[model samples]
Target: MQIELLVFIVMLGAFLLGNFLLKLPVSISMIMGAVLGALVAGEGFPLRHLFEGTFVYIDTILIISTAMIFMKVIEKSGAMEALNVTIVKRFHKIPAVMLIMLMLMIMFPGMITGSSTAAVLSAGSIVAPVLLLMGIPAPQTGAILAIGSIMGMAAPPVNIPAMLIAGGVDMPYIGFEGPLLFLTIPGAIFTVLFIGMRYCKNLNYDEIIKNLNFNMNAKHGFKLYLPILTVLTLMVLTRVLPTAIPNLGMPLIFMLGSIVGMFTGEKLDFISTVKDAMNTTVPVLGKLMGVGMFIQIMTLTGVRGYIVISCLGLSTVLLYVAIATVMPAFGAVSSYGAASVLGVPFLLALLSGNQIIVAAALSFICSLGDLMPPTALAGNYAAQIVNERYFKVLRYCLIPFTACIIFGIICLIYSKNLSFLV
Candidate 1:
């Protein structure tokens, strides 16, 4: 028990120091925590253990890296820019139609990219000016971007973290695609629309018209759509298609897409593209390495087991609250942090076949941290683009976020296949 308490304190101290004192990214902080925990726990900071643990996260790094490269190639090719232009021109005359379409456009990329920042940076630039000109307040515009971008993160193909957690639970990766689309997609759409509609209610038609006139010309043409198509096709082939064809995974799909994207256009500069892709890939790998180390350290110190056991003793409602509150702290540090620290052990404990209610409840609640404040990176990026305060956007998100958590818990309770802990 003393060892467990010491480990817990060391882990928490590392988290605080990294997040507040050092101002390091949450993933780095997690790595720090793991290293510190290993040292303090008398494991003597084994280099081999750290290296092996870092190797475990390579899969995650590869997925994010390739996806980032693919996105960068798409962006540079001017395909994304053209798509934005097309969207704005088509919807310029109809505010309500434009809003819905824009929401979908942002959401689609997020689903594919799995990076809320990518979603906003890709879609928000185009949409921001339109909203600004239309008389939408900066805060409201930010709220729209934040909410729409979040919807994308919760969607399919690109939600790698969700896939990882689901995979950890012994659930097939593809199996979760269906549940996410059916349950989480609606939840995301409703959440975005709810916030958007409330803000849109007071706007005048003239104000909306004014926003429509702000430059709809594409810097480039629809030729760029090819890369986007390549990504989508690869996603379908790897995620939706059967393994009967042979080896297919997200990394291979991205590599193929990058190759195709390079040759498809007039320039055909494969060498530079690959180099650029590598540059983007490295930092992402570093981040995942840190996260993986954190998970390894937690396992070493036994805090994960303690937390799971402690959670098991709580009632369902209390369990939900505990998870919801604690997850944000980890999540704020890094999504991967939440995944490693809470997700792995939580899943392990729940999978004991004795705590399905709590397992499902925790899984559902964990996703909400992506939108929670202080470290709500998704919301922060959206706010930056639209010029809204972070807290304001978070306030609008409160209800929908809460609802999803509640619905997820109820789903777990009612799921016939899930066993309850009591």
Candidate 2:
């Protein structure tokens, strides 16, 4: 076998051994893989390359760090809770609408942080009891949360996997909002409607209201929502009036929003909240760093080029099948890992299509890795919130999971037709 292929196998094997056998953090496993791959390729320690790889995603890391802090701010300041309560109060009369809205609420954090764990832990916790109060079973509630969180992780503004894939190919992380929204919004709506709509048809508004803590909305009213609005408005203005309004990058936007959150709703210890947010964000950041190292080594050893060249030989149908299966299956390790290792190659193989649309679709599929077994970050946490086994949540997610794969493949196949989105 070629040295590049051997190095690739060594890296992948090492990652699996470390992650499944040794039970290392996915980030560390990836780092182990990178180290092993470098040794196999006779690259010595390659410390300089490894360190360079860590900085490959520095911009994305900044976005995630600031966005997590922003998420923590809204969550701690009661802005998130207030919004949940307000959604329930306004839409309780319409179960379908309410379920969709709640799913969106569950998606909000992941949308910002590009980490499904954040959404599952923060918004999923807030929405779980409400779904239970609506008579949705624990398993189905967990499924809804899991699916919504993954979809959120794939959404616009901060989709790390998409960003990684784009970065891998040296593509700009721009013009993705349209394709991402197209994929995730409908996917999120379908998950909630399919999993929770039947149970939520007759929601108990009085009971839900009694259980919901809406003190922020009650005390602060419209002002409680200002931070969220500021972030949204700034994101839009930067896009809409790029020439007039300086395009504050996502990191700055999130930081500005976080600062606004400090004073908008509840009083919070800025230092403590920032520390907590950073603490929660470190693992994900590590994963990004590891993926960077892994991919950097892959590139240095010619493994990345080998994979792309190998993918170029596949039939379109086989390529689709690979994406539908291999990407998510590998995601069982780490979605970021799957994106950097597989997603980048797949994107290159499909370069005949609209690059932006194809990258967006590929990222959507990679995001589903968060639902894969053993290390189902979103699924595990979502199940915990609903007091259900992760497998039970996976069982409920089978249909939506399959649907997302089919939808993503369709997006890939028709990417050229969808170029208008870019």
Best by TM-score: 2
Model 2 per-residue lDDT tens digits across residues 1-422: 99998999999999999999999998899999999999989999999999999999999999999999999998998988888898889999999988889999999999999999999999999988889998999999999999999999999888999998998888999999999999999999988998877776666788888898867887888877888999999999999999999988999999999999988888999899999999999999999899899989999999999989998899988988999999999889889888888898899898899999999999999999999888999999998998888998899999999999999999999999998988
Question: What's the lDDT for residue 399 in model 1?
Answer: 76
RMSD of each: 4.3, 1.0
Model 1 C-alpha lDDT per residue in residues 211-278, reported as the tens digit of each score: 44232123334455666677677666654456645547777787777666665443545667657756
The residue pairs found clashing in candidate 1 are none
lDDT against the true structure, per candidate, is 0.64, 0.92
**Candidate no. 1 TM-score:** 0.83
Residue 4 accuracy (lDDT) in model 2: 95
Stretches of candidate 2 off by over 4 Å are none
lDDT of 2 at 80: 84
